[model samples]
Target: MADSESGGRPALARRLAAEAVGSMLLAALVVGSGIAAVQLSPDQVGLELVENAAATAAGLFAIILMVGPVSGAHFNPVVSLVDAAFGGLSWRDAAAYLPAQVAGCVAGAVLANLMFDRSAVSIASHHRASGAHLLAEVVATAGLILLIFALARSDRAERAPAAVGAYIGAAYWFTSSTSFANPAITVGRMFSDSFAGIAPASAPAFIAVQVVGGAVGYGLVRLFYPPTVAPGRLVSDPRRQADAPHPSRERSTLR
Candidate 1:
């Protein structure tokens, strides 16, 4: 089943609350699953990838459905940032969203660590920041931003909740990065030394790519989906009054 809701934006408090809760859930699922997969089958690359993909899909679907109505379900800072760039959201919203996402991610990772036992936290995993892995993260994140913006700008937001989850699952298979798609997720993953751990040094490159991807996606959406509805029309144009004929003149003309 899908986890989504109909129209209307949340107020600042509601949005922040949603972001906090959603990010926590997302982080715990991502890190917790990765930890479990490795412990279950340490050398099975295919199994790891498959489990990771499933975890991402399930966790994301749940978060979106649960918190989407409150915060647009933007658990990722990059997603929120891109939404802001595309004018789907405002700067004020972004200001509240980014920090909440990051903090929630860190908190979630720590919680997962506690759940799995501190000694098993996976923070020591060497696979966290290999160059190839970092590169994969960049490409995967870019694709995600593109997908998010395209779906959002399309006449299809109503259809997006499903498309987004499916697209992300597929992207994990195709993209070299297994579709991490979110810097916050990446950062949170670092707390685990399991199959998903990413080194701190590698984070900058990943964040750079994600931010660039978000901006590019926003630009692409703006290019293709120029709003057909004018803002002035939505709110009556005061200048339209200035151009109106005087009632006295109209009356004289009629006479």
Candidate 2:
């Protein structure tokens, strides 16, 4: 069972707090570093992108390490949904996580702007809408989800921090949309006018594409790692001495 299940209210609260704080710090890092990069490399767009990506990748690794134990470190709503779908999280808690993630992201963007001495809630002017951009969002989000669950199913969950960070860093350069694969962060980016921000008008398409990507990723997971039993049913290897009978066998025996 998840820690939230066993520990109840206190655990849930702690997890929510971790998600909020972690998401806030992530947005701060993204926007602040983008601002700093632009100031430091004024005319060099590539150099600024390099600086921003590197900072974000490193910051993400650290944040996940710090918060993963608490909230599964899901700063992204799609990730929370996928986790719940896979039985790693309960739907009730997952429902709660979405609002927290979105709210935290918005607050984080405002805080980032304030820290950089800008208006706290300026609407982003960075227009990022195009057919290519929407396609990039889908690919970027799909790849992120696949990477995360692939690690989980393979029992390499411990490597997620480094792997996820690295993937995002690489995606920044490879994807046309600069890999804003996170829905919460995409919304957060709308509140800042820095290099990292996305225009408010462009956010809806990106978010919709991301949701589609998430569904595709989930379908891929089911295809590749088909579950051995129905939801809520346990299965154990018959080779193990303490194994319970298979559900079908148990039902037959009971009958």
Worst 10 residues of 2 by lDDT: 232-241
Per-model TM-score, in order, reads 0.79, 0.86
Over the stretch 1-255, how does candidate 1's per-residue lDDT look in tens digits?
Answer: 223222223357776878888898888887788778877878998998788778777677766767765667777888777666555567887888888888888788877778888643456344435566566666666666666555544433434456567777787788766667787877777776666667676676777777776666656656765643211111111232334345321110000
What would the TM-score be for candidate 1 when compared with the true structure?
Answer: 0.79
Give lDDT tens digits, candidate 2, residues 72-169. 77899888888788776689988998888888889999998898899999889999989999999999998988888766554445677898899999
Task: Give the RMSD in angstroms, all C-alphas superposed, for model 1.
Answer: 10.9
Candidate 2 overall lDDT versus native: 0.79
**Highest lDDT scorer:** 2
